[model samples]
Target: MNAITQINPGIRQQILDAFNFRHATKIFDPDRKISDEDFNVILEAARLSPTSFGHEPFRILMIQSPEKRELFREFSWGANGMMNGSSGQLGTASHFGIILAATDELMRAGSDYLQDHYARVKQLPDEVIEIFNGAYGKFQAEDHKITSGREITDWSGKQAYIVLANMMTAGALMGIDSCPIEGFDMARTTQVLAEDFGIDTAKWKPAVMFAFGHRAKDPEFLKTRRTMQDTVSWF
Candidate 1:
């Protein structure tokens, strides 16, 4: 039998508390900023997140420049409601991030990207690489039934969300507030990313965006959730 490590029971309560403490914070205290050490820990959490086939088909772009935030603010309708005067999460948050997911060309099996990834990054032997390619190809074509290019990109986006959630939860555990934003014009955002940020939109597309900071005001409403019986079923 494998060795089983002991875990503290109280650690579960602490995790629950952190989850309860977290919410989609709107406006943030502009004066307060997250220290580099703390933010690095959060980034590390994202880096350590798991991805399908260990192919980390995502990238994170940290938007710390005020000019870039302003450019995003012009197209981000989700953050507009939270704007205090001229600033919202984009303007006030201590840190902001955009998650980009790899496109079909990079995600499809037997692609040059996966070939290099399996060889160099994953360090798999040639035989193993051949096996994985077959398995992964079946997963993409048959198991998942990916029909269009968009579906492949969407699959990669699902992996990116894992990183996004870990980053936000890590911040929450550290007493930092965060809000995930998806309300933006995709075309406009893509244009800005290509023309302004100089990202290769063909290879990677924006999946999601989020902001982290200290909340300017505590939420007035209480957190609500469905009962376990209603939300989950046991065999």
Candidate 2:
């Protein structure tokens, strides 16, 4: 039996219930703001999420101003090419988070960020750190040869999604609603951030976003999902 089955039945049930209670919230109650303490817990969940090579390549951008949220909403509809009209959810959300992936500078070998990440965060010894540096250097070299660093964003974006999942689940456990938003014009997003917010997109690429708040209405209770037999197999 796996470790999941070994978990106490009550705790296992609670875990499953948390997942069941979470959904891509369609509409958020604008008046209902998330408490700073509870939101900090959600951010902590993202910080503690696992990432490839322990790189911790994602940066979180918290959208606080109504004007900025409105700007994003307009960009989503006009230039971002969102078809489902879900991007407007950002306008109604009490909390918004954008995950940005790190650039080549931070991921490079022997960089101060990587050095500190290993020595301080992971507490690796010098020998292990040296090994990691060599391995990561080789891996990054191969990555650049394969895609000229274009794939860096994709690679880091995958890690950000892991963070996104953790944050959403953490929020759900705290009775907060969340939606993972992907349908937005990335070029326009980068442009707006640079022109308006003074964020240099050359250094950090926006990967994904999440909106959090109280649900405006009871989300449609549909538990439809692919059966385990269809999606998984036993050897």
Superposed by TM-score, candidate 1 places the C-alpha of residue 112 at a distance from the truth, in angstroms, of 0.4
In model 1, which regions exceed 4 Å deviation?
1-6, 82-86
**What Cα-based lDDT does every candidate model obtain?**
0.90, 0.81
Give the 10-residue window scoring lowest on summed lDDT in candidate 1. Answer: 78-87
Assess the local accuracy of residue 189 in candidate 1 as a C-alpha lDDT between 0 and 100: 86
Q: 1-235, model 2: which lDDT tens digit per residue? A: 6564476889878778888888887677778999999999999999999998999998999988877876777656521225545545766788886899877666667778899999998999999999999888778777544234557667788899999999999998888889888877888888887888887777788888788899887766787799989999999
Candidate 2 TM-score to native: 0.86
Candidate 1 colliding pairs: none
Q: Pairing residues by index, what is the TM-score of model 1?
A: 0.95
lDDT agreement of model 2 with the native: 0.81
Model 1 score (lDDT): 0.90
Residue 177 error, candidate 2, Å: 1.0
lDDT of 1 by residue, 64-93 (tens): 999888898778987755444647788789
The estimated TM-scores of all candidates read: 0.95, 0.86
